[model samples]
Structures are given as C-alpha cells and as structure tokens.
Target: MAKKKSDGVNKSQAIRDYYAANPKAKPMEVAEAMKAQGINVTAQFVSTVKSNSKKSKTTRGRASAKKSVAKKPAKRATRASKATSEVSLDSLLNAKKLVEEMGGVEGARNALSVLEQLMD
Candidate 1:
C-alpha cells in the first residue's frame, strides 16, 4: 500500500512531547490526550516511544564502553588458553633434550647467560 502523507505532525514526536509534559502519564492516558489533539496514536506506540527514549537516555556511550571492556577480558583469556595449548608434547620433549645436551637445567641457565652476553 502507498504511504499516507503526514499531516505535518509526527505522531511519535507528539507522544514524546506529551510524555515530556507529563512524565508520570500512563500510555493509555497519553494516547487519549494525543487523540484529543487530532493525532491518531495507540497506547502501545506511546509506550514504545517512552521506553525507547528512556533506553536511549540511559545507554548513550556507557553501554558500548561496558561491552568493549567485557570483550577484552574474554579475548585475553582466549589468547592465554591458545598460548598454553600451542605448546605441544614434542616441543616439550625437544626442550628437555636441549637441556640435557647442555648438561642440565643449571648448566642450561649458565649457557643461556653466556649466550645473552654474546648477543649483546
């Protein structure tokens, strides 16, 4: 169906204006008031506008910040778990063999200290 032309007045805006004037007004009351002013709006539409306005006011930037902060911790945990899982048994065995070839863990540490000095 073709859209009906607006009578130059927005129904949702009318509902919001009425709600702004009467913050404690019920949806049915707002609907009745709008009907008296020749704006055809339902109580459900008024309720939806009121709720959406409240949600917009409450969640402006805080909600997005909260979501980003929450996601970072979960991503960090995923990265930590991935790092631990990537250390395979074969890699561990190779590391052990290297330590033994260096004579032991203490000897490996000493050798690493010497290698670090050489790299510098």
Candidate 2:
C-alpha cells in the first residue's frame, strides 16, 4: 500500500485565507489561487469551507446569546437571595405560626390561593 502524499499544507485554511483577502472572489477563483500556492483544492471544497465558516459564525452568535441568557438567571438568583435576606426572622416566625393555625403548609398554600383568586 502506498502512503498518501502529505505536503503539510492546510488546504481549508489556505482557501479560507484566500477568501478572506478576496471577499468577492468566486469558489473557482479561490481553488485556482490555492492550486497556484501548491495546495490542490476543488471549487466544491472551497464552497464547503465557506459554508461551514458561515455556519460556525451563526452557531457562535447563538452560543453568545445563550451565554447572555444564562447570565440573566444568575442575576435573578442573586436578587432573589437579596430579597430572602431582607425577610426578618419575626416575619418568618409569624408565617410559621400562621401555617400551624391553617393546619399545615398545604392548607396555608390553599388559603393563599383562594385569597389570590378573590383579590383577582
């Protein structure tokens, strides 16, 4: 078996570089330029590289959006923690007494739900 020739050249990078320098260049033009530079590539391969680069950029945009959304949850959690810290122990004890009077936590929640509906 014969080993495939390895010229140590990255054809995809070369194609991408050529396209970056010549943004309006066609796929065939990029292929021809790479062939001149000793990296044999087809126009189809160049087109594939361009399409893959565009997809990667779009995916990066979505990844950044997801990161921003993830940060929002952290901020909300911090605000919730601050709000919880602001609740006095007396208020918590009173709420506990109220829950016991209502018979249990579930009964208190049901009474609150009814109160909420009446308020609406």
Top model by TM-score, which number? 1
lDDT of 2 by residue, 2-110 (tens): 9866878877788778878999999999988888877888999999999887774544632444334332211112222554558655557667766865878999999
* Model 1 Cα lDDT, one tens digit per residue, 1-120: 999885798888888888888999999999999999998888998989898888745457524434344322111122224546576555566667658657689988998899999999
Report the number of backbone clashes for model 1.
0
- Relative to the true structure, candidate 2 has a C-alpha RMSD (angstroms) of 18.3
Q: In model 1, what is the error at residue 85, expressed in angstroms?
A: 27
Question: Alpha-carbon error at 48 in model 2, in Å?
Answer: 0.2
- Local distance difference test values of all predictions, in order: 0.76, 0.75
* Alpha-carbon runs more than 4 Å astray in model 1: 1-4, 57-63, 70-120
- True-vs-predicted CA distance for residue 31, candidate 2, Å: 0.6
- Top candidate on lDDT is 1
